[model samples]
Target: MVRRMTMELAVDVARAAVQSCRDAGYQASAVVVDRVGIVQAVMRDTLANRFTLQAAEDKANAVILSGVDSSEFRLNRQDIRPEINQIEGVLMMDGGVAIRAAGSIIGAVGVSGAPGGDKDEICARAGVDEVQDRLDFAD
Candidate 1:
């Protein structure tokens, strides 16, 4: 079975993402999900639109389902993007990144509400980086 991150860790990651985006002058939301696409934690910036929450969750779920970052999945599978997007909670877009430790995927972090997906992804990576040390040392 795939391992999952602690609730505290998940929350930290989500908060970090939101903070990162805020630092960049963009209001955003972040979602952390287990390997099974189950939501573990969610953080939304105060100025972020409520709709951003669903976008963030969908991005994270896409990572869990594809075993890769959402951007790569979307780029690599363009032919199927049309049909894949029709699936509930599955978004083939950027701003989603897998959370990995010791070569294993523990979860994912997805960010949304930035002006561009790439910017959102940068915040997501920052969030994951915030907890990288803890994740690297995890048992």
Candidate 2:
């Protein structure tokens, strides 16, 4: 069977991201998307802004759509087609990261509500690291 993100794993990823953000002294939101870019889970800290969830989802969607971390997109957004920017569910930000399993893009994790985009990205990366073992064995 093709490797795919499970609902349980999605929640684990989301929760881990939120916890990471909290540990980093921020109330944040996190979202996880499947390989197809479908949202699988979302979590928001009580103090996080309402928009944070949407932002997280957009970041994750962008990673899946572009096959690159959102930070890279943000850095090169000027060179990207304006039409690409118009696509719904795309956000050029630093908090989204692609989740790979056995060299295949299996999903992504995104975080928002940190003091800075880099902080948000750090939390998202923590989430990915939380499940590194699972990803490694998926090949």
Candidate 3:
């Protein structure tokens, strides 16, 4: 049986992501999506750009569809498999990360609205890493 992520875990991850972005002085929106691209949590800073929500969702979708982080997609655009990129909601940009636990993809986290894509990616990574140790313990 596949181990499913819980809502509490999703909420914790989202809050951690928001805090990480705020600490970096960048207001952003963070989204968490299940392996199948279903949204689990969405957090937007008070001062974040209005489009942050959509951008975050797009990033998460991209990671889920491609089975790789959004930064990888951005860095390897030419090499990205066409079938993965063709997913309806996927966005080949930065700020998305796939969450893996026990060697299985559990979800994805996406951050957006930062001044630069790299900054967004950094914040997203920080957030994901925050819960990675706990996730490991659950195995």
Best by lDDT: 1
Every model's Cα RMSD, please?
1.0, 1.4, 2.1
Q: What residue runs in model 1 are displaced by over 4 Å at the alpha carbon?
A: none
Query: What lDDT tens digits, residue by residue, belong to model 2 across residues 3-108?
Result: 8998988899999999999987899999999999898999999999999999899889889988988988778766774666688888787899999988888899
Candidates 1 and 2, the one with greater lDDT: 1
lDDT of 3 by residue, 19-131 (tens): 88899788999999998989999999999987898888889888887788988877777676565557667777888988888878899988898887788888888877888
In model 3, what are the clashing residue pairs, if there are any? none
lDDT of 3 at 4: 70
Which one wins on TM-score? 1
- Clashing residue pairs for model 2: none
Assess each prediction's global lDDT (C-alpha) against the native: 0.93, 0.90, 0.84
What lDDT does candidate 2 reach at residue 61? Answer: 89
Residue 67's lDDT within candidate 3 is: 83
Q: Model 1 over residues 1-139: C-alpha lDDT tens digits?
A: 5567999999999999999999999999999999788999999999899999999999999999899999999999999999999999988889999999888999999999999999999999999999999989877
Candidate 3 CA-lDDT value: 0.84
Count steric clashes of candidate 2.
Answer: 0
Clashes per candidate, residues 3 or more apart or on different chains: 0, 0, 0
